[model samples]
Target: MKTALSLCLLTMALGGCGNIAAVKSFNTPYGSPTSGDTARLRVIADGMVRAVPGKDCVDWYSPGAGVIAVPQKGFADRNGESLGMPKGATAMQGDVVSEVLVPAGKPFTLHFLDGGRGSYNSVTNCLGMFYFVPQKGADYEVVVHGYSACGVKLQQLGAEAPVQVTKAEYCSAMANF
Candidate 1:
């Protein structure tokens, strides 16, 4: 379900899918994704955004921490998908959230990012860029967002250790992890 959706045909823009496929965490700050750096493997940010190691969780969604980042470029005609905050298939519970932190038993490693968006012209797909954490109580390991189809996806990257995401889903923009 890793789609760049800028129209497809990328093995990282036509070079490789080589097949190392390893991830423990990443949103950066030393918490995963490295055999010393394997070129980002096309970046879809696995399992709550992975690239883990040990304690490298620096600052996930920082600005004001009320957390919401959806700087759109193409939202696939407003329905394909984008990480804004409005697009409804299942509508995803409520509040549009994702806040996570992992280390106890390791749920695919952990870090966080995700806001919310989708306009549902029947659901297409296009996603990238947008990070938010607006700055409240701080501890925001996630802030989540949702909208996806076919391959199914949802966001909110785990605000701080709350697992169980199947095709990806989010709703909880942050009031306190």
Candidate 2:
């Protein structure tokens, strides 16, 4: 009984220890108002991934650590390339920007790579997934933010108050991604 209680208390205490907070959404969406063009995606990466020097950030996605934000469907195509690592060295802090050209006119899932024990999130732990659809002629921004125990949380930000809330929902379809 004592051991169980100790473990519970420890978990509660460490719950807020590590967190990826204040993920700023982009100030402007990319591109102009074009009728038949694909929507541009501005992914602001703000989270924890056990960064290993000299390894492609995508490599860390396996069992250990890495940070990623990409389209939830058709992630890999043409050349079988999936959206994972952003285009630069993994920075332990601050925002890393990466853009993807999404076919406009519909909604899509955004996947965030929330790693294992290394992340240190003790609440709701798992892959952080959410739903978002891009608007034609406008850029869409999403924040990949979370720690291990907290799993992952995707927040869509608006330029002003009453931020338009993009449906941050989950579905069985995620299993297909």
Candidate 3:
């Protein structure tokens, strides 16, 4: 009986370890646009950010798209320089930015993940989703806010000032693909 109980406890602990997911790079259109019909998107985050890359969200565990690690502002490498952005991309005020190109006039979704705070016993991760339709030849920026909760803000860059884009509610049950 003692040996059976020990084996059962070990199995339960291993099951909990299977919940971790590997990070996958975004595999769609990236880098600068080749033509004049694509838009530039810069994602700013202090933690891990994963994107669905479509109008709808599928299975929560499905690896739909890419992942980016945006370290906190002023984070530097052993060489003491800030993290790099893509070629022809600019960093703002020491912010670590991940730049990508998405087809214009299409909807895109981003999932901001906050790894949470505190030690192993007290940590609680949070997730926030935001989607927006990009206009051709436009520039946009997404800022992720995280702490006890997670949220995101999208802005259309240009004009006299940046115009805020409204956050649309997303439901995975409506996934078309």
User: Which candidate leads in TM-score?
Assistant: 3
> Could you estimate the TM-score for every candidate?
0.22, 0.41, 0.56
Q: How far is each candidate from the true structure, as Cα RMSD in Å?
A: 16.0, 14.0, 8.4
Backbone clash numbers for all candidates listed:
51, 2, 1
Candidate numbers sorted by TM-score from highest down? 3, 2, 1
Off by over 4 Å in 3: 1-19, 23-36, 58-64, 70-95, 118-125, 160-177
lDDT of 3 by residue, 39-122 (tens): 767776656565554454422333335554445322211112222323332434434466666667756666665655544345
Backbone clashes, candidate 1: 51
The candidate that achieves the highest lDDT relative to the unseen native structure: 3
Which scores greater on lDDT, model 1 or model 2? 2
Cα lDDT of model 3 overall? 0.51
lDDT per model vs. reference? 0.26, 0.37, 0.51
Please give, for residues 131-160, the per-residue lDDT of candidate 2 as tens digits: 445555554555555442343332333433
What's model 1's lDDT at 42?
13
User: What does candidate 2 score in Cα RMSD to the true structure?
Assistant: 14.0
